[model samples]
Target: MTSVQTEVVEDPKGLLNEDDHMRDMERLRMEIVAIRQPFDSVMRVTGRIEPVDPVTWTLPNVAVRIEVESPAGQRPVSRVYTIRRYDSALGEVEIDFVLHDDDSPAMRWLHAVQPGDDVWMTGPRPHFVPDHASGKQAAIFADETAIPAVFAILEAWPADATGTVWIEAGSLAAVDELPEVEGVEVHILQRAKDEAAGTTGRLFAAARSAVADVSGWTVWAAGERQEMRDLRNHFRAAGMARDDLKVLGYWKKGTSSSELDRMRLAEYARMRESGLSMDDMRDADIAV
Candidate 1:
């Protein structure tokens, strides 16, 4: 959830040109319009951004890196979040922050942010979506941290495609918020109140038991780093295509995202030296 900031220069007209390569890379100032706790585990923030248009800004599973101050207020930190909903007509974007017990930068910012607060962010970076056009059944595995992304994906889900989603969360209410697609079935793996998140292997176990034949499925799994890596390895070993299995490690247990970002940056430097692009970098190969 950490990123390296890049400053993008705007064009002469004071608006990003549509053909600009960094159109989506520029810094965006979002004015907080509302903040609410839709569920015990989530803090929903609705923010308004400029130049909003359905065709240009609306994309499934888009993410943003919001700059926030560290607990000591001495340094700025960035945290990535998925856009849970985007209302182009209203020029508002909804971001959900998953609640955790730790006093992380994002958590601190979440508690301190308020209505009318303006936050600077970078992105609308489109993440992966299910390969519905492949004509295969989509298999989705997610934990609470990934629920916002799951919500966005389901909202834009194709009507003719079929899929199954397995979510691990402490509350059924969080799962209920997901859009119910006609051809998609969703199963919830509820955790106990005392149980810590990312500690259970229920998602991996359920996926192994339910998906007997990998040939008919395309996978999208994201959550804890180790769990996601395990899921990717399992499916790849079962002969699933590289492109068919889109797994991402949103965060790691017992590790801060800042540390993860550091490792990624080092690896990226190595890749750049070898004339490789960002697409050549693999999250599962990061070795924690």
Candidate 2:
């Protein structure tokens, strides 16, 4: 559910407009009227919105920019998040946040906010769409940071589509409850105290050994940087086609989101020069 809002600019009157190339950057005002924290590290904020009238595309799971605070309290920041829920009827939208660290920009701002607070949500819209028809099964791998996108994707999957999901977290209590849905097998793995984050030891071994059958799965993995790459490599080596796998680096352990975005873009440019679509590397007998 990641969208690019590179050209969106805010005017002195607080109105948003984008370059001609980005015709979809028209802004809509919203309010942070409610917030929910189902898990200690996860936060969900609801936006009391006005009718967009005809802009019915701003639904749940779309990518949006959430207002945040800076460490020095000098300037404001914006973090990308997935729309947890977009209730047109209720005129409200919800966004979820997973705190990797207490001082992270998004978490810091969230911690200081109250009901009726003002928060801005901008969009480049959503680009990740579940390819249920591409295969008989899809493999979804995520950590707590990506649970929002994972569940959002799962809910959008066709009723008849079947798949598996692996959620690896530092602690079970951290990702305590997950919504249940049919046709998907959810596996929750807790990281041992000594286990380092990413897909190196326990989590990797389990995903490899436990899921012996990886024949028809289209993989979508998002989490710590290298882990996502490793998981994708594992599946690719195990006879899965590259075009069928989608891997994203939500955060690079110690990197800031902005820094990571820059790294991602540079990597993307290099990959494109080499003719890779990031999501599509190999298509030999695989679904796109």
Best by lDDT: 1
Cα lDDT of all candidates, in order?
0.81, 0.62
> Candidates' TM-scores?
0.89, 0.74
What C-alpha lDDT, on a 0 to 100 scale, does residue 249 get in candidate 1?
92
C-alpha displacement of 255 in model 1, angstroms? 0.6
Name the lDDT value of residue 236 in candidate 1.
85
147-255: candidate 1 lDDT, tens digit per residue: 9899989998988999999999998999998887899999999999889888898889988999889999999998988888888888888888998998999999988
Model 2: per-residue lDDT, tens digit, 120-207? 5556366455567785587777887777777667666677888788888776764455567798888888876666566444446656
Pairing residues by index, what is the TM-score of model 1?
0.89
Predicted model with the maximum TM-score = 1
lDDT for 5 (candidate 2): 37
User: Model 1, which residues run further than 4 Å from truth?
Assistant: 1-23, 51-56, 70-75
Q: Spell out the clash pairs found in candidate 2.
A: none
